[model samples]
Target: MSLAVVTLKKGEGRLLKSGGMWIFDNEIASVMGSFVNGDIVLVHDFDGYPLGRGFINTNSKIVVRLLSRDENTMIDEEFFEKRVWDAWEYRKKVTDTSSCRVIFGEADFIPGFVVDKFSDVLVVQSLALGIDRYKEMLVELLKKVLAEDGIQIRGVYERSDVKVRKQEGMEPYKGFIGEEFSTLVEIVENGVKYQVDVKDGQKTGFFLDQKYNRLAIQKLCKNARVLDCFTHTGSFALNAGYAGAKEVTGVDASQLAVDQATANAALNGLSDTVKFICEDVFDLLPALEEKGEKYDVVILDPPAFTKSRSSIKNAVKGYREINLRAMKLVKDGGFLATCSCSHFMDYELFTQTIGQAAKNVHKRLRQVEYRTQAPDHPILWSADESYYLKFYIFQVCSDR
Candidate 1:
């Protein structure tokens, strides 16, 4: 059967031409041939030049997500098996495979779908309708690929309940992909153990992208007082305790998070030195400032303050305020670890915001190092969304 042809409007596919996978709704000039949404279609330039093959969906602003740049490539079982094999091999080389992102959406060349491995289990999230149809096949293929390495996947779960699915004209969904199993799964990273709730916890149960960033702060925490703000599940605080920090206090507004963090502290046998508090970080930071409490190391790992371009101004203010307060809480010559997970908050803008915060507090920052999301979450150039995390470590010094 002949495939449908989608031709782009003149000068409208700049992003796609620049190695991006998406063709926005306004970029296409015409669709020739009959096909349903999610069917693979041939894409062409305005001059009738063959571009590639991609799945089309009029329901999304991102109308087409390219699957193969080779015009002759077939989108069959063989094609998907290679994609799975390649993604798995890349992770084994760059990150610890026990628990890590196996496929990172567009970065791994599988647009709008993500698969994360947690111990012997798999969690899949599909955000695009075009990819949604292939979710089960990809999951099965992933299992087959992992089994090649002698790894047995015990269960597969789906966490496609994100709001973005609505944009694709699909309803949110969550449940087991295969046979039901215990939803509570434990995984270790940087020597810290966590109980991941795959059924109900936030965004695939845990934030694995910060795996290395959490490890980076351990050297600075030994025998020092540490404060971890927005310490969800106590990953950083426990790392500090594991490093022999004199005292560690982790604060978060969610009582459930605080409870889990406290349990994790006990799980690591650090309950004596590490503690958790349930309170608003924004409110608690000011009260702690008033109390004149200081710490040798302060870590701020707040959730993304913005998810869209329109709210970037407010996100800037939020990042600046939290950073300024956290800096004040750090004693002179002490360490500070801060990060922003919002991709909309670009590197330049985030750095400028932190600099403004330091200036406002009369603190001079000596750069320690800068990092981004873990290697498993590879950042594909031209697809800026893949590079969301920006982490920085610094030595906070009092101005003379």
Candidate 2:
């Protein structure tokens, strides 16, 4: 079948010309060829210049997700195999390939699909209509490529039960993609052990993006009283405990998370110094303040407060509130590590929010360091979505 051609309005190809991979529906001037949702179509500038080939979905605001810029490039099995291999080879150089984000959606040149390898297991999330069609092929290619490196992927699990799937005109799905093995997968990072519940845990059962950020907080935790907020499964708390912190408190609203976190602490034999509490952080923080609670190190690794651009204003308030409370809880000369995982919460805005919080609390902040997601999750330049997660380590002092 002849591929459909999608022509963009004049001046609308600037984003694509600037190396971005997304084409908004509004930018499209007209559709000359017949192609349904999830079909591979050729994109062209108003002057009929071939821009690229992408998956088209009229249902999505992101009308087209460019897969290749070359007009002659074939979007076939071999293409995916090379893309997967390239992604894997890149990970080998910059990150621990044993277990890390092997493919990060658009950043990996595979738009709307995410793949995380945990030990011998692979967890995938296919979000876009077009990418969903090639997910199985990508998985097979990934296994083949990894096998070349002598690493065996025993099973593949799909965690496609995300709300975003609905936006793509597909029902959410979850379960094993192929042979079902024990869903309980164990992965070790920075020498700490964790049992990831790939079947029913948050976002692929673990937040591997924060792998290095958690490690970055270890140096400030020795003999310090540490408080980790929104400590999903207690990754940061465990790191603090393993770093020889005097005491570590991990707070989460979900009891299941607290239970899992407690078990994780026991798994590493850090339960003696680490504890998990099930309570709303907002409510708990105020009570702790009333009790004059203070910690030598406070870590805020909250989920994305805002997913879309429209909610950035409200997200700023949420970020500022938590940061203000966290800063107040830090004793003089104490360290505070705070981060926002929302891409909508841009770097400059997040830093400004933190600065405002410090000022509101009348605290002086001595910048320690700044970091982002682990190198494994590469942030492709010009692709703003590739860059989320802003982490800052600061020493808080009393203005008085």
Candidate 3:
């Protein structure tokens, strides 16, 4: 039995008993026997009974992130294959999706790791030291998992560019494991098609998490002039154009994304009414207001301003500022579809932020709908920490 010593409170063992993974430093009763970072440890309650075993990182606030309970389940090639295969099997049943989260740590019973499948290609992110150490088996398991599913081998691209890699002591790694392709990927979302950039695009090439929200905004854009702000790939604009929007404009800071959006617009033959602007979204709003520009529908889906605990307050301010400026450009009785991708800031904080912005502008706001990540990113009930992305569809009201 992989044994060291870490202590938990009297009743605190309950969560661990229920297969919970996290063990905060403060929750520890004490540590006995020296355990280096990422070494396996045997956890116990006050009574000194074996609770479970998992990897321990004394340096992290999360002192321990449990990997497995049973000692017999060796942390070897077979161990990774079992978990990877299980995650793959679950996704196949749940998703009719072309792009999906093949592994959602903890929810899929494997913490500190995640894998997203974009058609035949796989993107793996190792978020924990325990799982990060198992990279060899993990990759091997992926290959075997693909073989089992009969997906022809392409290559596994490791997009470990996320800041989470810092905790795992891993450097940023991205690129194709095998032959890379020059062309973009073709994926369908809610009957609308998109070409996703596998290598350089954001968050595993596209915000697949926001797949449903884009479609919801699409339904409201019919016969209306739509403005999609911070529009990476012009998803909202393109969807609106496809759903019968009169005209659509997508604004972003990146010329690359603007060009990608333009190419995407051409793909669907909607370039006639669709326009892409490579300019700052913040700057464009006031200029649009000055030019007496207005849109029947507005979408404000910006990149997350807050990525850590310290930046949450600033992120809220940024959210409010953007929403306030955006609300001013919306036509009376027009809809504003906004979203927050920062999981550190909860929905309550975001809603209140937007609510205050609306009040300051003296605009009546009615929430038309709420949206979250598509079904592929399932929330584990035992641990409700899974919910991250939130979208709000609101209608602004003036004298009209």
lDDT of each: 0.94, 0.93, 0.81
Model 2 residue 398 CA deviation in Å: 0.9
- Say what the RMSD of model 1 is: 0.7
- What does candidate 3's lDDT look like per residue over 1-110, in tens digits? 33678889777756667757888877889888876788888787888776667888766677888777764455667777888888778777876646777788777777
Q: Which stretches of candidate 3 lie over 4 Å from their true place?
A: 9-20, 33-36, 69-73, 76-79, 178-183, 381-385
Q: Which stretches of model 1 miss by more than 4 angstroms? A: none
Q: Rank the candidates by TM-score, best first.
A: 1, 2, 3
lDDT of 3 at 198: 73
Give a tens-digit lDDT track for model 2, residues 277-309. Answer: 999998888789989999999999999999999
Name the lDDT of candidate 3. 0.81
How many clashes (backbone atoms < 3 Å, residues ≥3 apart in a chain or on different chains) does model 2 have?
Answer: 0
* Per-model TM values vs. the true structure: 0.99, 0.99, 0.90
Worst 10 residues of 1 by lDDT: 193-202
lDDT of 1 at 394: 98
